[model samples]
Target: AIRCTPPDALRALTRRQVDTAELYYIRGDVEKACELAAAAWPEPAGAEPPVRRRALALYTHTLLYTQGPAAAQKLVDDTLAQAADDPWLRSLALAFAADFNSAGDRPYARRIAVEAIKICDELGDRADPIAAAVAPMALAEIDMFGGRGLDRSLIERARAAQSGQSWIPFIDRAEVHLGLSAKHVDDLGTSQAILTRTLRQAQDVGESSAMLILQAHLAYTELLSGRPEAARAALAAFDAAAREAGPGIGEPGSLTVSRALLAIMDDDLDRAEAILLAALERLPPIPIVRVVMDTPLGAIALLRGDVERAITLLAGVLEQARAVHVNEPSVRGRPEGDLGQALVTAGRLTEAAGVADELAEIGARLERPTLTGIALRVRGLIATARGELDEAEKLLGAAAQAHAASPMPVERGRSLLALGQVQRRRKAKTEARRTLQEALDCFTAHGHRPLARLAEAELARGQRAGAGSVLTASEQRVADLVADGFTNREVAARLSMSVRTVESHVASVFRKLQVRSRTELAARFKQ
Candidate 1:
């Protein structure tokens, strides 16, 4: 109909094309939507202000997913230049800029979002409704991405502006931001409830895109709240829904991170590695996505007993996260703690000490018990490595106590395990057994198989004789070789013994050292 219309009548038909493009976007046909939106106003400078604004909004949004952020950013820049005198169009352009920048340049995003809101405020009753609604939402999104506590005033303003707009996408986005803000504050219960409820609303309205993103958010919240089974279920549901919806409907980075975390919990390190590596190839160069994905890869390296590799991976992630000012406890905290552990394992105590201090400062600044607990645990590990058993015991105990204030079962279990090891080293047999049992119960209930196995080994060690009394010189040699990544056959060859004899010695060393696997053996050797 547009092409058949007279050239002079084309202006009247443009709104129809923009509306159709929006419908396409809502229906998940993003490429088609981009095509239509782009066709509607090929030259923004020549089109009417209102038509150009609508075309730019739809085109840039669709372009973001189809052609990447750079293309969308270019369009937004052009629109901003063209709309300098038009407060409404300028505010919308700023809002778009703020939303995309939240993924990368968070501080800048926050600044511009505030500026957009100021423009709307000055315009007052004359401000465009969409611009008014989106400006505050963009600021709230930047706050969410930065892991700063959400400003309820901004959220309320966005919600109020959205009233009577009938813009389903922005409405759903506001709700998601609210849900994730609860998560940022570690209010997992509220986050889960809001996300679940919002997801149902989206589903009821056939909002497929919102539903997929909400599923990812809910799964991440479940994982953090120590409900791995529920997290797994949510992820499975997301995958099934995405498959049915074809493609371009889900948030790839978030879904990838969540799935990789689940795999890590299940001890499927290879699967997690593959998932993250694949995502690295295809995922955009967004700072937050890179940080989240690489942190888990560092964890996988750490789990494999590659101390140097883990240190290198985690250190890079920590540096990038700091560069972006990623103060979120989960994003920066996890990698920082892991890097400290890796440094300690690699015998870099000074660097590990610096990491511990940084964590403590971050914890105090954020007022998050979880970060405080992690800092204590890292400090305790450093103390243990330095052979200060009393300090290790004290720190680990405090770490466990700090974690008890939060609902982080995995972190609490880790502190208990570390404390039990310190107690055993101090020859507090009864206390060590009790602590180990508690750690075991926590890991078992959370289905953390890897950590549960470590706790079980610690318990078994408490039941046996001391390491010095049980292991002979030959067994010690075999143990040292195995912990150094030498196979039993290689150890036997190096020691001029039979493979069977080496195997027997290895078993004795494992029993005496109270370790269940080579990774544990390596950790014991490092300590």
Candidate 2:
């Protein structure tokens, strides 16, 4: 067995270690990758250079992704100094450099990524195929989308470069494969099909440790894609797997998110808010969680009609999204779409138009049907608020048409109600009645009685205004609350509504009773 060694004998240990590090990296186990790779560096005098360079590269990559740029910068600077002549090592370090500045300097990240790609190209097809694959894979995530987000060609290149390469293992390929799959992960049918395959593949290969996290991801995907039953089942499976693996296992952060989404589905905002805030505190505010959880916390505020607070919450999430290179659409879509809605509700029409323009830019870049519909709906609201009836009708018509195809009924129902409001405002009584009736039908079909009543009141000459006796049930409650001298935020808390919506209801109370101040309303109620 010790008769003779191969020409690449010196590469044996470091090469195998790099392969194992890639496995940990793919599993989201950054610490393990760092641990394995940190020991492979400081290459011995006569060792093959690629093995030593790869270990240094992986150590930097893992450290950057997990601990962030500040923590890894010194190590990267030191290693690159030693391996300055190595094209493969330099390409990886530059890509990690792009990621390092991703939050602080996006323009710089693009510049660095371009340089990294050129270095990889210099290595060519015959030399350092793994770097050839990884440079583009890393670059694809950081490059400017020309407002179109990631280019398909770059993703294909990353996938293609990995072909016929023995340096990267099959297990390490899962992350790359799943990165592509996460695009369709917001749709039920497609998500389930793709996730099932991913889960099965992990299982077939006995990679159960990776499956623990994958199961939670599939569950979260199910929660978003409109399959609560399937989500519930996936969660159960995840719990079982997590328990079987013992304590401190899998990513429970996504589980917390799934629970919050479930609460949202049940119309339990109070519960959803509590869970979201708790998780936001407990988990690191990573890009994926910000997209999935933090944005929803703002949605809860918006649901309560707390438009100002919603804006504050969503603005922070959007800021992070712009800084980080999270190419997932769902991650970016929520804050952009809902921030516009919040502005519209706060009667900030000009600002709402700005938000709408931002969303339209996203829609143009992403070309997603749901986001495009929301942009249209928000634009229609801006038009309607400005009394541009004809333009509002055109925009609203397109919005309704787009929403009609959405998996989420709330979207379609919202567009219908908005259209009805425009019709009523235009004094198109017959059209208003039909449109409002359709809106009512939609809400009722979805078992949304409270929303249906809002539509019914719209059809009744806006009876929520002008007289206490004529006040709709909601308006009556708002009137009593106003009489009690409660502030908008307090009343919102009491009624599980937003402060802005409460302000609107209070304004209606003042109009109906012809009262100017809270004191006046309170005295009238005293009678």
Candidate 3:
């Protein structure tokens, strides 16, 4: 019976082996599988028809998993060259290529993914769920790069096709869920649940590497949920899993960088600095989310009053961010947003406002409320500095609403603080008090110690009206600038008026308020 085994049975054995290898490769056991597949490849000269082709495909994935995209590219190209007319080979080849391209320098990944998706769809019952998963991921990745709204149509297509599919589809589903959650941070519960399920499935199938990745995602989500301790625990779990699985288990540099951020959040500046420095030194030059990593590090440096380090890191990050195609989706518009914040802190309000404008436009297109709120807040601060109270009020109010819509408690609390400041300047003392108190409560609840402290300080100052109801046009201009918190020069340039005109307004406002300087005017409003 063994000697007389049917060709069909032999072919089935080969297919099962191929599938097994794929499972191992995806789970991060690339080195072991690749070596075994390489030796076992070149199937018996006259073996069943599908055996050789299946082995080639399996070997391609093994190479990809072990050596990354470049090696995978060669295997796909070679396979396509050999079997130019085979629909199965073509579909597999193109799908792998598209997956590689999706991570490449250009945006060609989406196009290739779509073509493969079409081929698979036309192939009907034989369609590969893996290809289907790649298609939408590529498309969504493209949409993210442009800072544009994601194509729900494509995402829905992937979701519909993933029903009862294999591990590949589930992995893809996890990615899609993460993308959506990133866009809508308020949907943390849904996102976390999706990741949890995906991780379980991956673990059940021995896809340890994928499980680790999903675990990291869950950790980050915990960070967003304001559970730093839980986030740390998750990261530690990932670290242990990674060590057990060995290398080839996806990137860990970013995870290490994330740990630094947690340390910073905990107010452990020494630990944060030590971790960041170590990770930065060990990480490869080709980093994933480089700008995002650099921006947070810069923020920490700035917080520690390491202005030189902040400038170096922030400026370097911004340059790289701008150098990119300006359309990659992973970091969203965070690079520009970070730069704007850095510029504002460095007293470059004009540059900050410009960047904020760009970020706002991008965020609007993406329908990401948190980013929009950030952009608006930056602009509002600029306006306040320019003495544009009316404009400041409008921008601040919009920012507050956007923050309220965001799922991030910390962001919401910060927005409340900024809005309260604007209201206080408007002489709406009751409203300001209410808003400020709400901010204090939110920050306190969220463990945002610094913001809560600031809110408390603002609330402790009794309210006072520095400017009267009936003011001259010049005084009105000054009031606007004062409320917006703009510099004299910025106000003049924005209004198309002279610096002397702005100064004259400020002088007149000082006389009316009987205040010595702008600082006194601001203090009076707060009091």
Candidate 4:
């Protein structure tokens, strides 16, 4: 119909093309939608402003999903240059800011978002409803990536405004933000409920882009809520959708992190590291992504007993996180705790103590249970290193209590592990067994294999500490050889025992002796 129209009637025909493109977009035919939207654009200079603006907005938005943010950059820049004061153009600017954000140009994104908000304020009653709704949402998103706490009121206001407009897609966008905010505040249940319901709505309308984004968010929320199986299913669905949508539909940062975490849960450190490294290469230098990815990488190093590498990775992550102003527990606090643990493992007690102090201060100031619990766990580890067994026990027990009200079972399990170890050191055999059992149960239930192994090792030590002696006869023989500087394999050869049994006995001996290293064990034996 458009091609058959007379040359003089092309302007109206172009507008009709944009309307048809919007219908295509609504029906999830994104490639067809984008082609039509792009064709409707570059309208004649004398064309209707509303028609041009609508075409530009649809074209840029659809292009983001079809060809990524870079493809839309020129159009957004050229449109804004000509109509900086246009309300619909201002709204388009807000949407473009969000694209820049996802592309990792946070400062530029923030500037555009703030300017759009100011323009919306000036337009007041005359402002486009979409612009009015998106301006605050865009700014809030930037702030969140900057490590600033989410301004949930902005999301609420956007939702209220969008609701009045009766635009289902716009309302779904607001709900996505709200769901993410809930996740940030540790409200896992609320986050899951909102994302799940909104995702269903998006699917119902064939809102393909919205559905993909929501699925990514839901995957991460499920991971955080200790539902790795659910997270895996959601992420798989997201990947399937993106594949069907074609090559240019890229994975979101949240989905990348979720995949890495699932790998970590499966005890596949190599796979997790590979996932994170790939993300760093392909994704923009988004600070939150860096923090999240590197922290886990550091933890994998620590799990592998590469103390120096863990410290290096974790220290850099913490420094990057500190540059951001907000004290978001998951971003800053988790890295702090990880770095502290690495420092302690390296026998850098003084530096570990300093990290503990800073973490405790942040936890106290924020009054968040997760942060407080992490701080206490770190402090407890430091105390154990210093051989303050009773203090370590108290701190770790308190840390477990702090995490009890929180949804993160993994953290609570960590506290219990520390408490159990401290109890073993203090000769509280029954208590140690009970605490270690609970820690093992928590880790096993949550599918945290690496942590569960640590609990198992602790339980093994507790069993050897049965009856009167802290070590069994076999463990005593292993400790004697270890104190004489014999390696596990060497000791196993001498004792005619398997290397695995020798290793287990060696670990039990170290815990029973309250020593951090072989040298410390040698000294204790000499005394």
Using all chains and alpha carbons, the TM-scores for the candidates as numbered come to 0.85, 0.75, 0.75, 0.81
What residue runs in model 1 are displaced by over 4 Å at the alpha carbon? 1-12, 42-52, 143-147, 170-172, 466-527
Model 1 per-residue lDDT tens digits across residues 254-334: 678878888888888899999999998877677667788888898887766666677788888877887886766574437
* Model 4 error, position 406 (Å): 1.2
- Summed over model 1, clashes come to 0
By lDDT, the candidates rank as 1, 4, 2, 3
Best of the candidates, lDDT: 1
Candidate 4 vs. true structure, TM-score: 0.81
What's the best-to-worst order under TM-score? 1, 4, 3, 2
lDDT of 2 at 431: 84
lDDT of each residue in 39-66, candidate 3, tens digit only: 4355545335445544654676667667
| Residue-by-residue lDDT tens digits, candidate 2, 1-527 | 11243535646656666777877765556678888787566555524676676676678766765676776887867756866787677777776676556544567777877887788776677446555555565555555322345554765776677677564533235243344344442244554565677678766654555677667767876655556777788888887766665532336676777777767666688998899788778776566556667787887776665778888888777666665655444545356656777766566778778767776666666656666778898898778656687899889889888877665565666677878777755657688788888888876665444456556655654433435466655677667666656567745543435567788888887887788999998777666
Segments of candidate 4 deviating more than 4 angstroms: 1-7, 23-35, 44-51, 63-76, 84-88, 91-95, 102-112, 166-172, 243-248, 278-289, 321-333, 353-366, 465-527
Query: Which structure among the candidates has the greatest TM-score?
Result: 1
Model 4 Cα lDDT, one tens digit per residue, 191-242 = 8998899888777777777778789989988887778889999998998888
lDDT of 2 at 109: 70
- Assess candidate 3 and give its lDDT: 0.65
In order, candidate lDDTs are 0.77, 0.66, 0.65, 0.74
Superior by TM-score: candidate 2 or candidate 4: 4
